[model samples]
Target: MARLVRLVRRYFILGSGLHLVACGGGDSTEPPPPVTVTITPASATVNAGETQSFTATVTHATNPAVTWSATGGTITGAGATITFAAPLEGGPYQVTARSVADPARSATATVTVRAIAVTVSPAAVTIGAGGTQEFTATVSNSTSASVTWSATGGTIAGTGTTITYTAPATGGSYTVRAASTVDPSKSGSASATVTPVAVVVAPASRAAFRGEPVSVSATVTGAAVTGVNWTASCGTIAGAGTTVTWTAPQSPGNCTVTARSVLDPAVASVSMMTVRPAFLVTSLGDANDGVCSWTHCSLREALTAANADPGTDTISLVVPAPVGAAVANTIVLTTSLPAITTPVHIVGPGADVLAIDADATAGSPRRIFEFDGAFAGSLAGLTLTGG
Candidate 1:
């Protein structure tokens, strides 16, 4: 009985074969027909820990017995059905089926076992800004034992398990990957990154009166760790800090301020500012109820504008006495005033008429006039007393 279950259903495959059978029985004894065995699927590739079914067809012989064997790996089957199990590693192999009746006749198919996985070593890496590192890939279950390499944001060299990498000059993230040479689809990957080391300065622009102090700041990042070296093109830097003081030149002009990393001279930042002659007070605003440029006639506003100006600005007091109410001559300050940083004269109507009363509620009066070391200004005709 010829038991044919089904055609090949993906177990693995074998090459096709051609055979002719001639059976003639007229004399009393009859000879057996020639037996041809063929395994479907001439060639195939499969991953490890996987299975593919191979079907065999018996030609010429009725109730034929066929045996399946492999050059590598394992197979399981009965009758004309055989399952070829791929090895854990990747390699080229062969599968064959032979007719038991005609031991000399056989059919063979090619098999290539594929790697289950390929893992790139050093799963994660970090590199300094403009640095370099090496990478490697390890392939699992591959008899071929070979891999191709690649990467992002940098140059990679060499092949197989080991390779060289040159990091990007700037700070950022990057990765490396390895693919199995035998099985292109089977691959693994790794990662690397570049970090930045430098410093930055701020207050991109500013203005100060000649002989006045200019305020600026600096920030350090990445590698420039120790501190900053400050420099001024047209003035003298008085001190060192994230925020620093710079005295302007006696002649009105422009200046460039810079902060360089103590660690790396190549990394630095700069700011620009101008110096002017003098700034005269514009509005003798009594708007001291709140803080603003307009509406609130607070001296805070007057002085803030004066300090913010780039020149030697003056703050002259001239009160517009409200018609109905007594002229509010006393400028009572509840909070401490901002430090004066420019060269400007502070003049008033009279020492008695225009008084800067530092405290009305506090037991002790606060200082009313705070000066920057570089401020060159005159105070007259104004009575000022503060704690």
Candidate 2:
């Protein structure tokens, strides 16, 4: 009986101890949630060599820190916020924010890098009508570095960076544009001003007697200032403007008249004027005098002056009528007239109104007038007898 009681008491004590341990000895703390990371602005775009910012939101982590990294380009900063710099090369790039507590818990953002820019040389220029100008284009941030050219008011030739622009026949403002072949939207432009100038002179050719005044006019086109400057090679200009009077020189020769544009000195037009010699006969007697005055010029004296002059000469005869009952104005030749060495044309009032009598009492009768070798002359409106 004593042994049985001891066994029961030991069994009861062990059972009570097990029950107490099961009721109060177990741990009561709960485990933390999983670590998670998310990024702000999951996607973005930036230019080459440009910058972009990113921020990360960390959850269920003891240490709320992030490490920034990129597949391409450079990344800076720490913690949740980071700055990303795009590389010079273009295309898609990846940016990642990894959790410091757990590297496996990371967030990624896509960044698109664009690298196209265009520029044109000779930003501004001026060209004449039908003139040509060359332009060059420079492309940056692009591997191709090629550009297409276009013109608003001219024709473009060639392709790529270098091209020629030919101005239209008309004058006006124009524009030249260059666009990147990689990115057509990225373009540069240049300005062009076309100015066309021309000049024309009236009476392209003319014939004038020495000391005579000739009228000349000029026409200017395609210029802001439609005025011209007149210049003569062998004559004097009377006035200015589109119309001017030019006086032939005292000697017979070829003269050139030039009309230059006021806007452009290089543009001009020319006209030619021929000057010839002329003489007048005012006396009724045909005497060979040493001098030939303008007021009292005999036929012999006029012929002597005409022969002395160079080039083709002209003689005008005007003899006064007798006092009363005169059949016609008669010129009695006491001496023969001078031989015509050069080309000449003698013109009188009328054949019936004037008569040349070659009968000379002192000297033997001779031809009325002699012509030298290779001399070409004409006589009209006169009566000749007693040759």
Candidate 3:
């Protein structure tokens, strides 16, 4: 009975040991996580010729490095981070990052590129003052090819790419600008020069003495080329450009001075000038002679010559000293002077020094002067006695 009890205890201990072994409670093992790649900024939009950066996150990967690529444009850099450069062409492009550890597990990012450009046709132009010009704008690499137009000077009319520019009444330099409707920053410009079409000459009418010099000037409005061409109908023009000297001719007549625009020959202005004749009386003798020489002219001779000349005439007296010391400074008229038929102005020395005496004791008493026909004349600085 004692031996059987000991054997039963031994069998129970062996059974517990076998049951623990069968449970299998040693160190445990688990499967590694699957390799995956994810990219930041899955989608983006940028302008052409621009740059963008992308980073890739690789999970459960033995090597975190990645190779960069793109469907279009250039891609640079290495590792998880890379730079993408967009091309000049406008379109949608793709950027991809493949894990070096697992090429099958890669990430892709969409990059849309846009190229915008603007241009102006007939970039430079010149127009007359108060004139209008048409301009057009062209846009590229855009679905909406419309543009906005503006001018630095003058009035702008119409809308869209095509518009009209009306120059101001005054002339100057100006600019016309065209900007894209989608992108205002991208724009183009054109140069404009507004010129004057009219030429104006100052002093529309004037009266001048023969052989006199007159100053004439012209104003040219809104012209890129300034100044004018001076011309005279009966006088000589001196100098050039906007201002000139006009010397009246010796003959007395009506003259016209013209200033023509250098830019437009058809545009011109004219000024009317009246020329009058003048005479000088060097002798105080009362001889009723009709001839008056240039060097020695008597008062009576000056009067006769003035009546025959056209237009208004002027006579100035300058008496010579008598040969005898007792001779007086006087014109002793024997007969009436010639009748004045035209308008004439007679100017003498001082009234206190010179005198016209009509007292005739031998023949019939005569008057110092006579006027015939309807005319206007003047006598100044002369004493009349004994008519």
Per-model CA lDDT versus the true structure: 0.70, 0.82, 0.79
Q: How do these models rank on TM-score, best leading?
A: 2, 3, 1
Candidate 2: minimum summed lDDT over ten consecutive residues — where? Answer: 318-327
Error of 2 at 387 (Å): 18
The segments of candidate 3 whose C-alpha lies over 4 angstroms from its true place after superposition are 1-35, 44-48, 60-65, 88-92, 99-104, 112-186, 190-195, 203-209, 212-217, 223-245, 252-256, 260-268, 272-387
Error of 1 at 154 (Å): 2.6
Residue pairs whose backbone atoms clash in candidate 2: none
> Looking at candidate 3, what is the lDDT of residue 387?
81
From the highest lDDT down, the ranking of the candidates is 2, 3, 1
**lDDT of candidate 3 over 288-375, digit per residue (tens):** 5566654567778778888888668887766754445333477777667788888888877767667788876655777777766588
- Per-residue lDDT tens digits for candidate 2, residues 68-163, read 889898987787888998877689999999998999999999999987777787999887766788999998766567888888887999987899
User: What alpha-carbon RMSD in Å does predicted model 3 have with respect to the real structure?
Assistant: 10.9
- Candidate 1 global CA lDDT score: 0.70
Better TM-score candidate (2, 3): 2
Task: Please report the candidate that would top TM-score against the real structure.
Answer: 2
Candidates 1 and 3 compared: the better one by lDDT is 3
lDDT per residue (tens digit) for residues 222-284 in model 1: 642447899989888988877798877755578999998765567788988786543323244
